[model samples]
Target: MSKANAHVVWHPTTVTKADRQRQNGHKSCILWFTGLSGAGKSTLANAVDQQLHERGLKSYVLDGDNIRHGLNRGLGFSTADRKENIRRIAEVAKLFVDAGVIVLTAFISPFREDRELARGLVEPDEFVEIYVKCPLEECERRDPKGLYRKARSGEIAEFTGITSPYEEPLSPELIVESGTQSVEESVQIVLRYLEERGIIPARR
Candidate 1:
């Protein structure tokens, strides 16, 4: 190991994750929403967050565009940058899990390998991969940000589903049909899964 790295040591938190979970009355995990641009990942994630907030559950969403404006501002849309972006977000999500908060992350996360690495950062049950399934044509049709148009005009470089690639999840824990389902429907599906898995309590 490098001398600089050898000097760094791990420090445990005073309050444990279980302690926080017990006090919060819900288990902590990351709801990883992955899909192509304009596939409704951000919409679903925020909608679910609102539901959890209304239920007084400890939950938060780390959105792609919002996060890029802050934590990942300097990162660009390149293969290596995308990989690093996912890595940094995964580490942040791990910290959230340790704090016993149900965190939701909505990102394109185009590479399966990078998503797998993110999943590996937490426990088996802690990583809930939700694939927002929508066809390329549908995504282009619903291009809310005009990203598809820009990408097609060569104004954007290495954009997923355009110049770049998006590797779909082989077996996600849940698949939300974003093209056909309304935002409310998609939110319920995610919330139902959390309740079924005992991560969050069922509606009383």
Candidate 2:
């Protein structure tokens, strides 16, 4: 370590705390949902968001397809692009958290390093990782978007669980078994976890 390499810098900004609080009206956090495609990650995330909304909590969802259409439109399914995509989304999620809005992100992600990097970008309690666990066969059977079929049929390349790989989380904050559990059960589990953590008030 060399002090000569370090430089002090300051950037001026004028945004008051009250202003941000009034704009979002709730504490901000990042709920990172990871799993195989067709594992019900998006479904569970959206359902949890709906429950939070009913409780007057402010939240937004960052989904895979939705982001690819905009912020990550230029990115592809390559390993490098996938990492970059998660990096960009993580940065955006950090911004949303600072703005006091709960951000629910649903992505395969498929790499522990990228997920860890995303977690490192935010404060300790601000990031929550939910593992939507589902067997490969079950995911293929569900095929919510027909991606599994396409990947198997060569219509898609380097798809996770097909030509590529999906690295499961070693230790996730929460686990939702989409294959064996009902959607409502999964939603309730997530809601309970959030409530226990005081992210949201206990349901009435």
Candidate 3:
């Protein structure tokens, strides 16, 4: 990660992204899922990932907790750490896109500036910002991870949507109400969007 090295060279691959896309029979893009915890971001992301896999499309899901287990392990929950976490995630997601895989990222990613930083890394159309719309009270009600409970108890600090804030997307490309709809319905909505946008071929 040190850019200070003078001998580093950018190596261009012979097989370009376009070639990879043609071989895979679909274009690659980033499906960025952002919401409060317990809002079904991970669930809906994996659901869509499963649907894509069933259709023989190359896709991957980068969940926040999972990523933190390795790639982002040392990072903490502070504001500076959160920004670094998102920056690294965006870079990695960009690599996945370049490799011709539709990468679904499920992260709270509460800051609009951070989200926009990710969006700016890719072609405008290749970045799909999915705002998983669910009220804070509803998310707290679900509390699948018990994070909200801990936050309320002062056991955890800087927790998004509780002690900290979640900046909702001002103009997300897609909005899915995971609070009300079934996961199946949400998956269908995403698939349809990809097809409609010509990111993937129509259903056969």
C-alpha lDDT values of all predictions: 0.92, 0.88, 0.92
Alpha-carbon deviation at 90 in model 1, angstroms: 0.8
Candidate 2's C-alpha lDDT? 0.88
Score every model by TM-score. Answer: 0.92, 0.88, 0.93
Candidate 2 deviation (Cα RMSD): 5.3
Give the alpha carbon lDDT tens digit for every residue of 39-105 in model 1: 9998899999999999999998998656888888899867788888999999999999999999999
Error of 2 at 67 (Å): 0.8
Indicate whether candidate 2 or candidate 3 has the larger lDDT.
3
Per-residue alpha-carbon lDDT of candidate 2 for residues 127-193, written as tens digits (9 for 90 to 100): 9999999999999998989998999999997889988889899999999899999999998998888
How many backbone clashes does every candidate have? 0, 0, 0
Clashes of 3: 0
- Model 3: per-residue Cα lDDT over 21-76, one tens digit each: 89999999999999999999999999999889988999999996679988999999
**Cα-based RMSD of the predictions, in order?**
4.6, 5.3, 4.2
